[model samples]
Every structure is written in structure tokens, then in C-alpha cells.
Target: MKKLVSMALALSLCLAMFAGCGGTPSSSSTVSSGPSSSSEDTSTSGFENKELNIAIFEGGYGPEYWEEIVDRFEETYGVTVNMQISPTIGDIIRPQIVAGNVPDFISMNDNDTTGLISSMIRENALLDITDVFEGPGLEDTSPLKEQVLEGVLNTAKCSPYSDGKVYLAPFNASPMGLVYNKTLFEENGWELPETWDEFFALGDKAKEKGIALFTYAGIHPGYMESLLWPAIASAAGIDTTTDISNYVEGSFSSPEVMEVLANIQKIAADGYLMEGTVALNHTQSQTDMMMNKALFIPNGNWMEGEMKDAPRADGFEFGMTTAPSLNAGDQRYVMTSVEQFSIPAGAKNPELAKEFLRFLYTEESVKLFAEKAGGIYALKNATEWSKDYVTEGVYSMNDVYNMGDSMVFGFAALPEGSKVTPRDEVFQSVADVMNGAMTPEQWAEKVEASFTEVSNMAK
Candidate 1:
């Protein structure tokens, strides 16, 4: 298996581009569509008669960004964009997809509960949009691939199959790890730990103050992947982590990985985790953490915007850090959550959908996204380009890249007719482990059994 390299170099360049920038811009001041002249000459020749049907999962980022971009795409191409966006978009579109009436483009994620993307991967039902990246970007003459963050497109998140063709396009690049209240840390003079030993030591200090060291969305154990995958890379190596993703035999039970698992088990066994954590849903866990019941929670940068209306401790502000390393001065890794976009294999207007996909990478569209969504796109230098529009917290989250490498986690796509999912094997049993109903060794053996089944299917 090939080792996935770090995106540190690309992020270093992004940092250099915004060297002296400071302060976040107000919404009103950051609402320009960018220079219209930059996009005036682009031709939409054959796409004039075509209409696009798009399905978007309206989550924390909201639908305003999508609506704005769709309008711009329609205006530029002289065509109609019929967009269906909802919080339950998957449930709404699942029937349509089964009836062979799939939308031209979709903006849901693989980890979504509907299992739509996972199903599509199993059935090989997604369109091959590789040319969209290989072709020129909407804003410039450079290939669109060059505009993406380094090491982002090659992952299973974009290319589900181990084969080299890309089906899903990268939407946003978000850093995921432990989220904490920055103000609390400052008030207590608590230092962020670099090594696991320091991490446990800090947990002891936090516990003295009646704060548990960690918690997570127990009902949605998948959130733990943000911490687990990166910790594995930091402790074992990227190669070993990649092997786990590829379902290689013994990868999960390897001595190094077992040690990482044991440490995670120690969190539960030693009472470092918050009490009743196993019963709380995502919102409940996050809300409690914000109220200062816990020192840190494994989560993504979106936690702030997602819980904006929820009551929190006074002066609470979001802060993110990479997973702790095994030894001092060892390399750390921050798992990046890259949402996806794709065109279905069955579509009325594949060409028009492809055009709309490319249109999203334009400077105007990128700026609108930042202004309306308060998030950065996956394109290179996007954080720098939209720095004025995003919040200070989000900007600071991007700085985590400087402390560690960027990692994207996705198991290779399962073969058709396979009965088990990687999530079912790996994460679903986390509650059992935390409850002491199953030991870490038992967890590893069970996961290896599932991996064996999947490996046989591939063979």
C-alpha cells in the first residue's frame, strides 16, 4: 500500500499568503461577488438548453451558500437549476434514486445515516467526474486538480475504490480533533499537551477541578474516528493507519495499534471519560462540554456554529488541537473531514452538471460560500482568499495544520453483495467497550473477523 503524505507544504504556502492578516470582516463588508470581469469571457455555449437537478443535504452550513451558487451558475449559463435541499434530503431522495430518477448532482456525505453514498459505491452507481478536475478551473487556465489541497483528491473519500479514478469531488476541508473552550484554558492556565503522557497529566489536573478529561458523541461513535485515526498515525505510522483503511489482515490487532486501543480503553477503564457519556447524543454531549462539564470533546470545527444557540459557559470560545503524539517532539496528525459532491451515473444532463461542478470552483462562488456559510472550500489558498469572511475561530482552526499533518480517513469501498460495513466493524461497538461489556482485545478480534470477510469478498 502507498503511504499518504502530509499536506503540510501546501498549508505552509497558504499561511505565507496571509502572513500579516488580522481580524475577521463583518458580514456586510465581505459580501462582494469578486470581480465579474474575471469570469465574463468564459463560454457556456452548448449548456444553454440544459437544466441541472441538484440534491443537497442542508446541515450546519445551511442552504444559503448553495442557493447563491446555484443562482450564479444559472445566470452564467442561461439555464435553470432545480435544487432540492433539506435537513432530511437523504430520506427525500432515496426513493427517487431507487426509481431511477436520480438527480444530476448530489452534495451529501458518505458517513450520512442514509447510506446513500455507501450504497452507490457498492453498486458502482456514481458518475466518473475525473475530467472535471483534470480540465481547466473556472477561474484560471490551470487544471482544477492543481487548485485542490495537496493529498486531498487521492483518498478514498474522493476515490472510494482502490483504483485511481475519482467519483466524488472535494467540497470543504475541515479539521477534526479535540475541541475545547479556549477561554477556560486561558483562565486556568492549562497548557495544551503534545504527548500522551502530558495529556494524561492534564487530565489529572482537570479532574481535580471536577472536569472530566474527555467526552464524545456517544450515540454517534463515528465522531471518535476524528481522534482515533489520527492517534493511530501519530503512535504507529501513516503506513499502519493506511493498512487499517485498506482492510489488511492483522492491521487492527498489530502491537502498535493495540497499544493505541488500550490507551483509549484506559480512558474508560480509569474513569477519565465523563459520567453518563455513553447515553448522550451528539447535541447533548456537545452542550455539556460547552457548559464546562468536560475539558475536551472529540469533534470538528463546525461545533461552534452548530451549537451557537445552545447555552454555554461565559466567554466560551472554540479551540482545536491535533491528536497527541506518543513521545515528545513526535509528529502529530489532524484528521480532515472533507465533504463531497458527485453526479449520479443516471442523469438527464451530465454535461450541465459537470459545468455546474466546475462553476463552484470560481472565485465568485468561493467568496459567496465563505460569506454565507462561514466555511472555506477545499481549493488551494481558499482559506487565505476568504480569510476576511470567515470567523476568527475558524481561521484559528486552520492553524492546526502548522502543528501537524492533514489526514483524511475512509475505508476502501466494499465489493458488491458484501454484507458488512467498515463502520459496523470498527466504531459501532465503542459503547460496548466503554461499558466494559467487551474488552479492547475482544473489540480488535471482532473487527479483524469482519475485515477478513471483506478481504475475502475482494479476492
Candidate 2:
């Protein structure tokens, strides 16, 4: 990935964690030989030989409540799950793979690769799941695998293959949305805004009382798209995936795109964005919001979990919504992605890993993930949040669903190597505009320049 990144730009790739959420009880600290220690093995007998050795990343994305699913799988299969949990996922896997001691399974993919699974496939380091996902077992376990909203499969399948022969199953998904301080909005008698103008208008109102309108990390590439960038693309009607293609490099430099860019600049110029936003990490920005230092932030819907324990005297309530539209005509939809999980091709026990993944996708897992971790589940029985501003998000989507998924996926489905568009660079533009160094048109040109550089590199 030819990032516009240098030491100057930063991002929190794991949106599920830093954006305020808890995860699995990873076994990074506990040392074990193989399938002898993970939550997937509580029993000493029965399906003992069905033990699975899993190479999972510790912390961040794991669910603290995931042990129940692991225990269930062990009870049913009588297998011990040896979890090789590591804080640095790539570092942990690279050495083991080089030594040919590939674990039985890998938990998920990270952004620090040239799409590792595909590269591994070409390098012969991964297993081909063309047979597994196509196998009948998927239907028996997760019917939603078939009914999953379109983008879900893309995350599991990765690039170089989109015809389903999936190498991974989705364990959780974090669709980006507006995370607001429900208490803040209520105390001020503000309903969650339904349109972009309304959203900005609320910012003015909040500003009068010392609140920044919305927050986004202009520093990180992953969180950039994971939050505000797609909403910007949607505002411009650029179809993010299309703009991300090398075929049309000016996708984000059009007049429509600049207007969206201008709105961002306008917000900053009007003192709606928080001070020092450019220097803050995604975690810090959200923490600032949890502390009532900002009024709203563009964040994954899973953001609620991370702030559930905030010290708000009124127990801060958070809500989700698609980014308000550029105008009433653009569209009202949130940017979201598949956020799927996959097993590395180099795993030692692909079958056992598959079974374990199936167990994690159960209804029980869905509830724990949604209620405690604050994720919006793609499962059939997923709960609908009913209190405060969260309820507004659930009910508002029915009308907005008509706007369609493409509205939010423009940048999401972009091709590899296309670094320009709205990623973190958009935020840089936001900062520049606030500093009186660039106009929206100038910002758009700079974005065009970034895209041009990557496009030329591709050629």
C-alpha cells in the first residue's frame, strides 16, 4: 500500500478497539503448547483430539465475552483450543511461518500488509478456502453467510477473489456512524440532526455553549475512511469505490467533492471542530467526547462499548446515525464495511479453526457483542437499541435504507494502491483550511495531487 503516510501521519487501524469497545479474552500472556489453553478447551476428554491451535492477536479486537463461545465449542467438540495470542500480529506470524510451525488457525487480518492473505496465496503461504465456504457446513452454521449484506463477503474474501470461496468468516462488523453524547443533546434539547445542514446547525448551537461539532482523526488512514471520509465521499456523490480506482484519478477532485470539502473547512473556520484535532489520536478524540469536551464525532457504531464506563454523572448515552447529507438531496446513510475475520492459509488446523469461528458467530455471541460491546450485529436476532439517542439511529435507518449501500461504500470498495481520495489526507486538508492555508478548492487539488502520485506509481 503506497500510503501518503510518513512519520507525520498516523491512524488507528483497528477501529473496533480504539474507538471505544472491548474484545475477546485473548491468551497472549498464558503460555501453552497448542490447543491446551484457550477458552475452546475446558474439558479434559471427549473430542480431545479435535484440539485446535489458533494464532490470534491479543487485545483490541478480541471480545472479553468470547470465552463463552470458546467454552461451548470445547464442550461440543471436546477440543482444547491453544490460542497463540500476540500483541504484534504480523511479527508473531512471520517468524512462525518462516519456521514452518504455522499455528492451526489465524484470527484476523490487519492493515499492515500488501493484503497478506492474497500475497500469501500467491506465495503459497495460505490455504485455499474455495472448498470450505462452498462446503455445506457454512449453510448449516451461519445462514447469514449467504444473506450477509454485500460488503461483508468482500472483507472475508479480500481482493483477487470475490466469488465467495471465502477464506474467512465475519466475526464482527463496525459500521461507521455519528456517535453523539446523548446527555449533551438532551440537556440542550437537541434532537439528533437528520440532515447535514441540521447537523452543522446544531454545531453552531453547541458551540455557543462550548462544544465542538464533530470529531475525526485526520491522521490515520484506516480510521479516516472508517469514519468521516466515506461520509465526505457520499456528500459528493463520488462513489468512493469508483474514485479509489486508478482508471479515474480525479474522482475526488470534482466540483461536488469540493463542496463537501468546503463544508468541512467551513465547520473548522467557524470554530466547530475541536482545537488540536490534528494532533490527537482517534482514542484521545473519542475520550475527549466521552469527557464531554466535544459534542459529536464520526465513529464506528461500535463506539458505544468503549465509552460505556465513562465518568458521566448522567451515564453518557451514545447514538448512531448515518452522516447527515450534504444537502437534503444527496443521501442519508452511514459508511460501513464487512469488517470480517479470516484464517490464514498457513494455519495448522483449518477445519478446527472453521468450527471455532462458527461457534463465535452464534446468536449468543451476537448478543454479547451487541449489548456489552455495543456493536450492531448482522445476525438475524440482533437486538435493536431502544433507549435515548441510540433508538433514533435504529428507527432512522429504515427510511435511509432506501438511499442504498453504495452511498456509504464509495471509498470502501476502492482498489488497492489508490492512496488518495479522503483517507487521512482529507483531515490534513481540514487542518490546513482551519489554519488559513488552503481553500476548499485548493484542498481538493491537493487531494488530486495525492491521488495522482499513487496513480503514477501504479503505472
Candidate 3:
């Protein structure tokens, strides 16, 4: 929470909407409050009671935190709260959307595999929550806009499609990069690398000691993008980086992209990654790091909490740093991954849903979320109020901001009908390149073709 990145820096990046891949709807539950409300006040039944329905994506963090919050909201407003929760909430809610029975409020975690948010965004099924931000906070009269940290509300995550219209509200703030064992480095007297040369040199030394230089949550190749994108931005410059996200023609074939692919190739060709890593799940690869089978892993701050119960080498301490600069003196940019919230355009109680979202952004509610769920608000200049709830290993995220400027690669909505997403393609090619199935040139070419295809569709 110290040395937080300024909002000014956050606004400089090009933000875009992310489209979700469509899939069959999953199982779900519907809890309703005995019915009736076409108005904000009393229902047609002439009852003074208000009712609201919310659906939450149940991820590793679970839904208890939100259930408690809903309890408080219900207590305060004397309303009946209906809850629909599931790990597959996105898939579960898709059919509901089709049936014209959308929940009043919803939170689809960033890790949702079903891509529900993206699908909804692509269909323009989400309400533009711009007015919610401009309105007052639930706890106070000040405009919610003023209460937000600078740049937090301006990013692509909030205004997907870059139309200056906010459909998603920022939820959790996560800094991602290279996570390693500090104790291993200290015990071996290896200084953290700050440049590519130093990084490779250390990798070589690590390899000699029977430790692979790098590994990732291979099952989730998407995670490795965090590690690779910053390196690309640092070497290529921000303009080229922006072009990549915007699907600019020939962006993938740029010299900067080639550099990124080449570096990745070098790692693969050099035999630097852990053996059999391309098949590992997130936790399995993370376990490799915990057990010292691999020296480092590309992960977010959540790794610490996610791996808290796993075994670790004695004196092991989690430490995170930005990817080494492309060369000495290059500007390093750390990536921040954010979780988001939104209301459906068809939400029956849009007013109540907006009020609930505003409450979530309030100082007290934010603190409660951090305390109960170990989540920090995405607001800039936010502090570590939930420090006690967070494990020490995750605290390494703080070191990243203190070290340099930070930027997030905002999720871009791929043009609909594209067979594959640029990210999915990048990840697939990365696997092929790492495994020697594709040459760096081939990878670059594939990516370029995908970029051109998406660009053409956008036109």
C-alpha cells in the first residue's frame, strides 16, 4: 500500500473492452423475495419492503464476505436479499440473461473461466454505471467520483471499449510480476537482477544448481502474459505497447514484438524453464516454486494467499519484483490486475443495485471487504487497512510499487466472431515456442496474423 502508483500514470494506458467466449449455460439457483416491485418504493402488494437480488461468482475467496455485506445492507434498509452464488456463476447467469431474469447486482471475478462479463459486454447487456460513480457514496454525500483514487475510474477495466462509458466498477487491486524466494536469493548471495543480461546470467547459475530459471501456471498460460507484457512495453516503448492492445495493423510484427518473442525463444532454446512445466496447473507450478523445484514463477500477489498452506523451503520468504528491464536504464513498468463489478442493463432494481455498488466503494465498506475477504480496494492512494488479514508472503506486492512506475494492460474486447482471442493465441503460441513446437519467427507470424484478423474485423 505504500508508494502507490499515481492515477495519472494509470490513465495514460489505452483501455479496451474484453469479449467473453460463449458457452452452454451451467446449473444455477434462484432465490426470490415474495415478489412485486415496478417502483423504487413500496411494491404493488402495498408492502413497504424492498427486495434485491445479487449473484456473486464464487472463487477461491468464496462468498461469505459478500453474504455478510448483504446482511448489513438488508439490516439497514429493511429489505429482503436474494443471493445466487456459484463458481460458475457466469455460465449459470447466461441463461438467466436470455430469459430476461437478470440479477439486480452481480460480480464476476476476473478469474471467471466462463467469460460471462465479456459476453455480456459484447451484447451490450450491461448498464453504463457512469452515473453511479458521479453520484454520492452510500455512507456520505460527497460525489463517489471525488472519493475514488485518481486514474482508478479512468482505466479500460472501468470503461471497456474505451468509449468513456463505465460499465464495470473496479474491485480488487493486484500487482503482478516475477515472484521468487527471497531466502533462496539471500542464502545463495544472489542479488536480484535488474537487467536482462543479469537475469539470464542468474538463470544460468540457477540451472547449474538443478533449479529451472522459470516456470508458470502452465494450465493458465494467461498468467504468463503479466510477465511478458511488461518486458515488451519496457523494450518497445509505450506507444507500441498501446498499439498492441488496440489491435493496430502490423502491431504484432513490430520490432518490439519480435524482441519479446525472441527473448522468450531464448529462454526456451536455452533450456531454462522447469521440466514438464507446460502441463502444470496454477497451484502445481506454484507448488514447484514453494518446493524450490523452480526459482521463480510469474504470478500475482494472490499467490501468497493461495499457497499459504503449501509446503515451503526453510527460511523461504516471498518476494516480487518487476520484470528485469530489457537493458540497463530502461524504464520498468509493473502490471496491476484488477477485479471488477457491474450491473445488468436489464436489472429490475437498477437503483438499488447502484446504491449497493456505491456502498461497496464507501470507506467503511471497503475496509470491511479488506478485513473479511483479504481484498484491497482498487482506489489509488488506498492504504493497508486489511494488513492483518493478508499473509506476509503476499506483502511482496508492496515492494513492486516502491520500486518503479506501474501500468496495467487493460483488457481489450476482441471483435465479435473472431475464432480466437489475441490473448489466447498469444498464450498458445507461447506454449509452442517454449516447447520448441514453434519457432519464435513462427510465433511472431502467428500473432501478427491474429492481430491483422482482429484489426480487419474491427473495421
Q: lDDT-based ranking, best first?
A: 1, 3, 2
Off by over 4 Å in 1: 1-26, 33-35, 42-44
Collision count of model 2: 20
Best candidate, lDDT: 1
State TM-scores per candidate: 0.92, 0.72, 0.85
Clashing pairs in 1: none
What TM-score does candidate 3 get on C-alpha atoms? Answer: 0.85
Report the C-alpha lDDT of model 3 over 341-374, residue by residue, as the tens digit: 8898899988878767865665555555655555
Predicted structure 1: lDDT: 0.81
Give a tens-digit lDDT track for model 1, residues 1-459: 111112343234223211111122226755654335544554447777567788887776766787667766666667787776665567667877888778999998536877888888889999999998898976677989889999888998998886788999999888998898999999999999888788889999999999999999998898898888999998889998888888888989988788778888888888889999999988899999999999889988766666767899999988989888878887899999999999999988998888878888877777787777777889997887787788777777777888899999888888899998867768888999999888889989999998899989988
Number of clashes recorded per candidate: 0, 20, 4
Candidate 2 differs from the real structure by a C-alpha RMSD in angstroms, to one decimal, of 8.4
What's the lDDT for all of these models? 0.81, 0.53, 0.71
Error of 2 at 45 (Å): 15
